[model samples]
Target chain A: MTNFPDIASIRKDFPILNEVIGGKQLVYFDNAATTQKPRIVLDALSGYYEHYNANIHRGIHHLAEKATGAFEDTRRRMQKFINAPLSEEVIFTYGTTDSINLVAQSYGRKFLKEGDEIIISTMEHHSNIVPWQMLCEEKGCVLRVIPINDEGELLMDEYEKMLSGKTKIVSVVHASNALGTINPVSDIIKKAHKVGAKVLLDGAQASSHLFLDVQALDVDFYALSLHKIYGPTGMGILYGKKELLDAMPPYRGGGEMIKEVTFEKTTYNELPYKFEAGTPNIADVVAAKYALDYVDTLGKDNIAKYESELLKYATDAVREIPGLKIIGQAKDKVSVLSFVIEGMHHQDIAVILDNQGIAVRTGHHCTQPLMSRLGILGTTRASFAVYNTIEEIDSLIKGLHKAKKMLG
Target chain B: MTIKEAQDELIEDFELFDDWESKYEYIIDLGKQFPPLEEQFKTEENIIKGCQSRVWLNAYMDGELLKFEADSDAIIVRGLVSMLVKVLSGHTPEEIASADLYFMERIGLHQHLAQTRSNGLASMLKQMRTYGIAYQAAE
Candidate 1:
């Protein structure tokens, strides 16, 4: 039997759980969109501003030294968190979208040529899809999509067929944001490597749920948003192989990313800094360590066990409801439950649920292509986080029933 | 009735609900009761694309007054469309262009009008006003 963390105490760490909305207790089931911040993460954000609010990496003064140390410390923490060989492999970005764009612009423009094929899955978020499409439009590369089954699992055989000598890169989501399918990244990376194609995993949804080891997975690139992992918004990490990052050009040319600037010639900085331009999101980056620390304290294994139980409970309960069909039922999935009810619009369901103080993400969820592929306009998704409890899932079930009765 | 009178009637109707649940239930009922727009009128030209739901609105001049017929895939937005049609459908173009919609705020659904909500209500309102101005210019 797996030991789960005390749900009562975990809920207390997130103050927003106590919030009352529409005369009822708030049940936040929108974890996939963004997780609620813990008190420790919040304190870290404020503490940095209160104590050492100064420019990092440039200044030699006490506040600057302290701030820079704290900021760099997050990079090291992230390196260890994802098991990257070098701290320099972790490039801080605005978010996962920014990270993907960085790779698409820097790596794609530098290496990819005309008629080069890039493979992506139907389950990828718009962040992963649009950047490559933009690159393809510019570079004249062919974009191929790996289709999925009705159950939302990626077809491995079809993906194999799409691979060839022309395939330069294969970018796929590690875990689907709309559906909860935890993809087979190990096999995916190995297959891509066989064809001499680089692989980039959109780890935005997977980072919080799965244990990430970049070296073990042998992934060329992995992008994640810290906000979805119980950290502040506007901060993300892009893990690229050291050799690959060194070869790529800088994404944005600015102060931090530059080595020396002359009117005639300019030089770029090393490894991670080449991709990260500007002063960066210092406060959020510094505070993000605490969010990772929070996860560590809970033990990722314990958290995952509890969340899977929650997902199972929710799936079983919702399946019993008449005319409610689940969208994704993969054997392996994260703690996300997406479903569509007959004769009830997803937006209408969201409005009704919101009235009961139960928040579940409704509509296409930035996965319009995935929605279209599934022959659906959208689905009502309730994603669970570490802080969420079985009682909250019960409230969601109750709220959904109410929505059905009223809409019916 | 004038726009102000129509808005007042809606406000009075909303005032009957003691709780948000009842108010939403009434709104959903209004959505069901509202007639669907004609198949021909539900064209791409008439569609207002919101993030969550789509609203299709068609407007024409009935003599001097503007008549609006709208439908939405989402029930709540359809109810809001019904409310918009009730207040502005029978009014002159000049009156509609100048009319202030205060009923949504008075009825405690001003949040729906927020740009961030993206339920098509705000966009639909803009479309209605745009139609009013366009018809006035044409006249």
Candidate 2:
């Protein structure tokens, strides 16, 4: 057996795991949606709110200085988390949705011209698709989609053929939230760059599982949510190349983002502040540093290893259930296990599981297009994290049998 | 039963279960008991706006009373709608439009509803009231 983190000891860090749901112990298998916070992360949040609760930047007061320092400290931590070349390359946003929207507006809107192409995949969440669609509508640009195989793996050949000089932007998800497929992003970035197109990797799902190095991938932009990394919600990072961000226009207009105010013209602030408009989610940002530290303390490799074990157990156990079909069978996957029981509604499965205190997400999972492509409404998705165990998978298998017996 | 009486009865039924799981199972059973909404009525126009779940609520005036037919993609949401339907359907438009659904709180269901589910339930109630108001205006 591989050397992995102690699951029992690691589970102790998350107090929410001890919670009871529907008269049973909570079995949280919805990590892909958002992860439960560790005590350290929550304590960090409480520490900030209790001690230094004030607005960041431009305040001279002691509390303000303290808050600003704490807030900026998070940015530096995030920079190290992703191994970005410069700390200023990191721009905090509300979440992944906000980060992607920033890129779509600031980068896509300003640089992309008429008849240009933006290539995405069928597996992209609505957050990754809708913004570019809006941009396409405004800029008269064409949107191309990379097709996926039955296994939910992207067709690299089709993608290569689709790329041309007209393809100005190739935005793809680093890891699919619905499918759990870890895309070959480094290769995608290289190929896109070859066509003189910039690549934006939606790292919302990957950030928690993978150790990301922006310089190594040569990726132009990356968007991810910290909450999925066992951090706070409403705290996200948008890491862009310094030169690209310096050239792109500001996303939102607010006090902190502007360098000068005049009647005729306005100049935007430097690399990160230009994109960070309005009062950011400061307390959550501070909490995010602790979340990253928690992950660092445990080690991402250990988490991934344990989660992979859970996925293996789950996949094997679920497959044993007669008439249950697993969706997205890609070789390179995270811990998401999406499946549908024959002649059973996904909602029914979800309800049954919830009754057993096994929290699983059902329905399209914000990937309606992907569901449509699969010719199914949705599937019950049980995504595992480091805190989960084989016993939970056994419970899930038993729950599935009960659901089949009751509903069938 | 009258709308208030039906709501009170529901609260009483919910109290029988000591735990949320049994109560939830009972609710799902209630949902399952309801005849599925007719396919003809499940149109985009009938779909409730602001619902996280894809819930389609359709209503028509039956003489002086309004009859509501609804469905949801979520089983729990369907159960919630079934509860609403039991209370509001076959009631006078004025009664439905003015109804204060305190039974949810009394039944301990209000606290258990997820934010989205709460919003969905609110949207369902709003749609029911909108139909009531429309029927009243027509009269």
Candidate 3:
């Protein structure tokens, strides 16, 4: 038995947990969509706006320098968090979707050619799938998908066969938002390197639960959203190899991204600033460091251990419910428990659960192709975080029983 | 009954439930009791796509009265559609286009109308009104 963090105190860190909805205590089971921010993170956000509100990187005044220092400090923290070789490799963006779009437009469009194949998995969120599709449409590149088995595990052997000289890049989710399957991204990256293909891992879900070491994995690009990791919304990071980032064109032409802008000829900024276009989400980016620090203090391994136990407890209890089938039963998974009732619509279940103040995500989960692959419309996903407890899982189980009875 | 009268009746019916649980239970029962749209009417053209649930709505003018038949894969959505049909169906196109739908708010199900929920109820309301406007134009 692993020693878990004090969940009672951890839950206390997030004020939203105290909220009452529909006359019931809020039980948040939708961590996969976005985790609730800790007080430290929230305080950091308000602190930035109140204490040091200024446009970063350009102003010479005291407030500007302070804001710039804080914003850039986040980059350094994220670099350490992900074990990137250089802080300059961490480019801030809107979110995971924006990060992927940057690579698709700048790297894929610039390098990929006709007949060049881009490989992705069937279980990818729409963010991962759509950007590459958009790139392929423009560049005349072929898009290939690695199929999954009945249990939502990637067909690695099939993926191996799919890789070849034509494979330009392989993009896949490190941990699936819909399924919670912790993908074998290390093996994936190694195989892609063999075929001379770059690899980009969507770390939106994994950053919260898994230890991210980009240098060890030799991953070329890593993208994630801060909101999913207990940080503010509208903030994300795109960590690309310095060499590749240096070679790629700028994603957007704006003030920070440009070194010199004359109508005749324009020169771009160095490293991350080249990709970070305009004034970034400075306040959210500043607050993101506190979120990461919170995770660091609690320890990722501890969080993972506790969440896994939560997943096991939830899985065992949920299996007893009649007509309820769990989806994506991968041997290696995070704390996501996705299931579908035999005769009940997921939305109907969501509505019932909502009234009980149990927030679960019920839908295709932005992974339509994955749902189609499983031969199901959607699943009701109850994802756990470090702050979540077994009692909350019990609440979810009770809510589900209520849903089953009422719907049945 | 006029649209206003039908809405008042729905509000009155919902007022009987003391708690949200019973109110939702009533809505779920209404959903289950609500008839499914005929197979022919569940075509792609009739489908109103919501992010969470799929709704099929078929509207046509029955003489001078506008008639609407709808179904949703989600029971709660179907219940909402059932309410819409009960209140707006069999009314003149002009009447439906101008009808105020205050019962949802009064019944404490206004959260369903939120765009974030995207249960298709909001879109269904809009589509019904669009149909009403279209039929009225033809007249």
Task: Give TM-scores of the second chain, every candidate.
Answer: 0.97, 0.91, 0.96
Winner by lDDT between candidate 2 and candidate 1? 1
| TM-score head-to-head 1 vs 2, winner | 1
- Writing each residue's lDDT as its tens digit, candidate 1 over A139-186 gives 999999999999999999999999999999999999998999999999
Residue lDDT tens for model 3, A318-352: 99899999998999999999999999999999989
DockQ of each: 0.89, 0.30, 0.88
TM-score of each: 0.99, 0.92, 0.98
State how far residue A331 of model 2 sits from its true place (Å).
0.9
True contacts kept of each: 0.84, 0.12, 0.84
Model 2: how far residue A349 lies from native, Å: 2.2
lDDT of each residue in A1-408, candidate 2, tens digit only: 244567887889999999998579999999999999999998988999899999999899999999999999999999999999999999999999999999999899999999999999999999999999999999999999999999999999999999999999999999999889999898899999999999999999999998889999999999999999999998798999999998899978988999998999998888789888889899999899999988988888888887898899999999888899999999999999999888777777776777789999887888989988888878889999988989999999999998886666
Error of 2 at A20 (Å): 2.0
**What is the per-residue lDDT of model 1 for residues B50-81, given as tens digits with 9 covering 90 to 100?**
88899999999999989899999999889988
Candidates' C-alpha lDDT = 0.93, 0.88, 0.93
Instruction: Please give the ranking of all candidate structures by DockQ, highest first, separated by commas.
Output: 1, 3, 2
lDDT value, residue B51 of candidate 1: 82
